[model samples]
Target: MDLSFLSEQVLWGISVGQLIVAAVLPLLGFLAQSVVRRLLRRVMSRLRKEGDLSVVDDVNRLLTRPLSFLINVALWNGVIGLLDLPEEPLSIHSWATTLGMVALILVIAYCAFHVVDVFAGIATRAAEKTETKLDDQLVAPVTNTVKLLVALIMVAAILGQFGYSATGLIASLSIGGLAVAFAAKDTLANIFGSIVIFSERPFQIGDIVEISGVEGAVEEVGIRSTRIRQFDQTVSILPNQTFTNVEVRNLSKRESRRVRFEVTLTHEATVAQLEDFLDSIRHSLAQRTDLHPDQSMVRLTKLDTNGLGVLVQAFTISTDFAEFMVTQEEILLRVRRLAEEQELPIMPAKEVRLSGEVGEPRSS
Candidate 1:
């Protein structure tokens, strides 16, 4: 190796030593980043074994790349300061500094963006420990709000770096915010409605509920809309604001379900037969464990030109619709059997009238 020849050779008006140093600076930065990453991996492994890794995992994910970029920029800046290049009309150092600053800001913004996810993960883990699911549902919206805030801050910082006044920009946005609010009123209403859902917890995922005449099981409660899987195998998407404004009946939360209907008998049924029929039906209902004994009733309700109407009203102990329907069918079947056994005909009454003299018909 000829050291004298290497020193004499010039590239970009700099000697071989300055060029070698500039090239080595980036390599050193890369090496430093690798070492830090390896250390972080080891720490993560240890934390995983300890079973308390949420915070550590979040920190590693949010800071790893930004920290590496910061180290690389710092080394490059140090190398640039050490270089003895000729200062011309266009300064290379100034351009390099500006580019470095821009990169730094970008890296910082990226870190800020990912930081929201980390915090959200931490909050979710914390929420899982408690019984209430409202906090769990809140994590997503809170994360989005935090990301938006961080993005705004990053934009402000970038503008400030470029010698623009952020105050003026913010004031301008403030003036335009009213128009934006008017334009996005429904969107904002939905977002607020989601907040209300999380706070109030009118219904939960998988709950059977009736909202705006749509009865179904709740699939997902989202920021903009709620997805409900209907009983007829159809999905209904209602805006979140609808829940806030309209009624929501959570059937799953009910303690008991009422079953009420009128059973008609023929006009030939005597009073004793009807009373016996009611007693038998009431006794059968009392035997069923699903029926609420205290709330059960069977009595003569109305008498019309059709027949005698007996009102049968009872409350089932179960709130499940399927179970309630099955129990109701069983009760009705028992009532039909009782009517057949008692010789009381279960039919609608008919009125016969002769308006004029009967005429003889010819045989065909």
Candidate 2:
């Protein structure tokens, strides 16, 4: 533990310079780091005043720690270079510089990733204001691709620092990628299907769509699959490729919902009663604000053995399911009141025969 022994021991064959410089370099590095941080704070303050707050905040948050480390490394590298060390095959200075360069590359890649994420958030916010969801869906994929590219570049730079060539690595990756594509052809097709979805935009998030006999509201459109929440509250995860293969009906895009059905009445009713019933229905429908004025019809469409089939076809102005149900209920109630007021017989006829006697037909 003697102080004189520390002075006698040489580090990398440097006896006098190692101990003195090690003690002084930390202090100098700290002072230089403090100055740089103060300058950065001032620059960030000015940026906040002139530029976007989010951009400035992101830059300050992502770069602050890496910049501090870089400044400290630079100061130490300069101090270490000043030492009078013996020539060796692998010196401490050379190792420190190499490590420093690699560390710098990693920090740069980290900052680039965060920057991409911030920009993606901004892009998503902008996309939300527009009606189409194509831009919104593209945000994640674009951000991830940018980050991957940045990471690949950083890897190449680091490899180059160690005197390794990235050409062979890239070629090997290309060949490996081809092999993977062949093995996972369906996965690639789904990915391409997602691209087609974003570009074509047949259906978007929250759209009520019917595809392959399944009807639901689109919850999320992901890269490989789309999530749909059914009317029964169950969720269905469909592959993106399914959308490309099948026809998708976007119910939400329909301007109005059609209501069509036949109301059967007893054949005992006279033609005058049938005419009055039809007239009453037309009058009621015309008075309704929910029904489309130009697309309503109430007419006797068929004469069956049991009764007359009165076709009531109309379109409601509302596309909402709940609203459509309410409008249909209102129309039915109005028809019921009209039939009751007019005293029109609405039951179907039945036939009966006597069993014991000579098969006489009778109405039961």
Candidate 3:
């Protein structure tokens, strides 16, 4: 088995036996890491199904690399010690130690990213329990901020490892950052705009808002931009700065959706028939729980060559677009039925169009 050559020195007075052990250590570490990950995945899967511990699943997935890196570093450090690397000439031992330290620092930073996710998970759960919705808007931006801070710190640590003064580096960055700020003034403004949104809170997440000539439910409020998921299923990422100065109409904040439509009947339709239709509509609207009882208005406001303009205005309790559309559908269908009951021709089927906002019509 060549056991006699096991004691022979390979380099730096290290025996072949020690070199073989050092090489085998990494292989063992790899096997151990794989076994540990498999066990963790199984355990996390159980925990995820049995309880509300979804965070464990995330930790298992995200921490694999950092954990594996840790094991590799530890094994290599042991290898370095076992080899008794020389201190003089190249300072290979010192260089290796320093490199390992930098690597450990990076791994720590990497782990810090998931640490933020853990806290964010906790915050999100807590937000769900709270009655106030403003807390929900903070989770994304704060999580992003902590991650950015972690990266910046990691860069500083790496700089210091190269014998650069951390304080001096920051001072230099402060000066350089000012120039960068000037150069990327728009970015800074957007960041500040985000701050304004957080502080002022003109509209919170999930609010159906019309802002900056765009209409949608606010999907996310990020550091530099606001994401609006439009009605057409497209997402518009507008600069945060765009919201700071523009008019923001929070449509969802309203108590009820304002619905206004003109139902035109034939010019030959009499005042008595129109009045009867209006009275019937008002009575029918009062019976519905979705509409505000006192607010329903059905008036014959116009008599022209075109037709008799029967203006129908009411406020629906629904704030959501789809729900409001359903309400509109029911009301329009009802109006048509009433016109048919009176044997009045509608000229053709009437159409409802969105002009200004949900249930709000544009001026003629």
Best by lDDT: 3
lDDT of model number 1: 0.82
Query: Highest TM-score among the candidates is held by which one?
Result: 1
| TM-score for each of the candidates | 0.81, 0.79, 0.62
Q: Determine the backbone clash count of candidate 2.
A: 0
Per-prediction count of colliding residue pairs?
0, 0, 0
lDDT of model 2 at position 278: 95
User: 289 in model 2: Cα distance from truth in Å?
Assistant: 0.8
Model 2 spans > 4 angstroms off = 1-10, 13-29, 47-52, 73-98, 152-179, 347-364
Model 1 residue 334 lDDT? Answer: 82
Alpha-carbon lDDT of model 3:
0.84
For residues 1-364, could you state the per-residue lDDT of candidate 2 as single tens digits? 5566545656666656467777788898788778878988888898888967876777776677767766766665565566644447656566767777887788668767777877887898899999987678779877887888998899899999888889977777997878887988988788888998898899888899998888999988878888899999999998889987889899999999988877788888899999989998898888889888978999899897868889888999989999999888887777878888998877644668555566665556
Per-residue alpha-carbon lDDT of candidate 1 for residues 279-357, written as tens digits (9 for 90 to 100): 8988888888988877999999889777888999999999888999998888888888899999998775456865655
Flag the better candidate by lDDT, 2 or 3: 3
Residue 71 in candidate 3, Cα distance off native in Å: 8.5
User: Which rank order by lDDT, best down to worst?
Assistant: 3, 1, 2
